[model samples]
Target: MSTGMPAYDESGDRSRRPTATNRTAAQVNTTALLDRLRTAGPQSLSALVQHTGLSTATVNRLVDRLIDEGLVLEAGRAAPTGGRPARLVGFNARARSVLALDIGSSKIAGAVTDLEARVVRRRRSAIVPGDDARPALYFFEALADLAASLVKDAATGPAPVRAVAVSVPGVVRRDTGRVEFAPSLQWYDLPLGALLEERLGLPVRVANDVNLLALAELRHGAARGRRDVLTIALGTGVGASLVLGGGLYAGSGGAAGEIGYTLLGRESLSTPWPGFGDLESRVGTAGMLARMRERTDALPDGFGPEDFLGLARSGDEAATAVLAEVVDDLSLTIGNAATLLNPELVVLGGGFGRAAADLLVPAVRRRLQGRIPLLPAITGAELEEAQLIGAAELAIDLAAAAPSPPT
Candidate 1:
């Protein structure tokens, strides 16, 4: 039987050769074993072998390497089955910390977390929308300071921060960690990751905010155990993240899930926010508020999206009408996406999405039922600080992949 592996040719380009096949396989096996240990709590070498289908020797070697790197710990032995007790191994979740930053349109938030992405400490600061003098630099400095303060305050003095992960409200170039565009934050073509790494003196990973939320949901929230999930964030603006085949699918340009830019109607150059797409311009917070203001002068002072939703829920006719229009637009957008992606689950998230879920979900569900053959379960986000949690998750993955230091 043929192995079905790529053939090696002396004249062919060296890069085309499957030189790292064995190495890749080994890495995958190691990750699988580690995941099992992390999830199953603790297991003996025999149990790990049984769970991962790897040879006992391979499991032992990987576990030993992980133990040396402080990523795995040899817990006390398990209870004796017949003759001898087996030594159990477990993931070392407190080995190192990670710093996460959520760079939102309105504010910047930071968190320090353990290996399992549990927040130990958090800090947040508001960002002035139209600051012309090095706004990004100032925010980066603040985040670095926040991280340092958290580390200093930890019970364990100056615990090592393995990596820094940032969630930005924009399209990011995954390869170079550049912010290609952020309409809400007014950032464009910025080398944000490198700048943050310089300020914090640590490895940095940056991703789109909605993408991070999707990752959080996939790992710890509503989308757990499900692949082909779509998470829609409705807040100051509309955004989405797509998780396909149990992985975050950043497209060729790292903008695969930028559903906010999907055109819903005719383009309008005269719109105040030029690039905000039709779907977002209609159903987003600003759009909803504008629609409500147009229909009713009775809106309470300092009215916001949540306030309007509350009023709508209480049977206020004008507020209800505004919400109905917003829901209809959201349904159209979501229905179009569902028709294309056919995801298993659709998660509603972000400030407005979570707040209006009670009203929006049922309405969207009804609309989808008529259009689509199979409707996905729509739900709100389970995690409160999803962007921060997801950033920590990305940091944890980066830390796990970093090379172990020399003994």
Candidate 2:
């Protein structure tokens, strides 16, 4: 269970200290320095001192220790000044690795990335339904197998991994690491974090898939550095993730963005929809398909939400009409979310979001223009794997922020 970091120095050592106050400043300084390094990359000792507002001696000592621990490295010299150019120190991204898992209703996608969020390995697996009696275990086994395979293939030189971040398609409480409910997956109160951590022998972090996507966007995509933002992932289920004050906003029960359960129109027996009273139940891919089927018996094979969008793009009249209705419905939903959250920007993401980007963005924008006096700017996610990409981010952020245990 030794994580390979120097936990303590019991024997006589020049740097070892027995008093808490002796190490308090170093700990605080390191945390502050790490944040700067993350944001601005490598810097000279003078630059670090100025950025962290720490003394030059303290910055130099911290940078030296980080370099010795392989957490940082001396890159080239800074620009030629009058004297010798100070050695530039930068974060050694390869020193730490993280595994990100994107668990979905019908498939699982995963990728291993370095501390800098560079993907080292990627894998995907189809998630066929379990015997209905043990769905949780079935999905878990698939995830474990994928993690094991990735770890085996990776170069294990680094001290294992700092953590694993799993993105689930529902409300995820960060404190408990429990997935409250993933209606698309029909999961509830599942200890997904503990299960993965125990199975893989590493720390595990979990978050709502849409929320994670928003985190990814904020970190490295369209929503970078934005304070108030909303990301709506349109997939098997419609969900929203909000970021306020530069941090993701999860409600009291971690159910802040369960937009799928919204009420939209009345239900009829002739059109029996899954989760029949819910709005997402009415407009989700399946619902749209069911309605589409009523109009045309010759529905295209494998006609899901993505296909519907493709058909719309191809100028299929039926498909266009269906997508138009979806756009209108989604526009209304977006307006409601915008009015309430008043986010700086609203990003449309996930499988449906990407495919219907051509359709959804314009419709949502137009809806906002007419409905609200003030509208948040609308945009589509740039990444193909927005959810999985965000999963990587969640893992790295948690690992960097975890507290060290006392000796």
The 10-residue segment of model 2 with minimum total lDDT is 5-14
Off by over 4 Å in 1: 1-29, 129-132, 151-158, 266-273, 403-407
RMSD of each: 6.7, 7.0
Clashing pairs for model 2 are none
lDDT of each: 0.76, 0.72
Q: List candidate 2 segments past 4 Å from native.
A: 1-32, 53-58, 80-84, 130-132, 155-159, 265-277, 401-407
Q: Candidate 1's residue-wise lDDT over 185-213, tens digit each?
A: 66789888887677666778888889889
- Give the per-residue lDDT digits (tens) of candidate 2, residues 263-341: 6555533455455336565467777888789777897587777677667789888877877787778877777877777
Alpha-carbon deviation at 399 in model 2, angstroms = 3.5
Clashes of each: 0, 0
| TM-score for each candidate, following the candidate numbering | 0.87, 0.84
Error of 1 at 225 (Å): 1.3
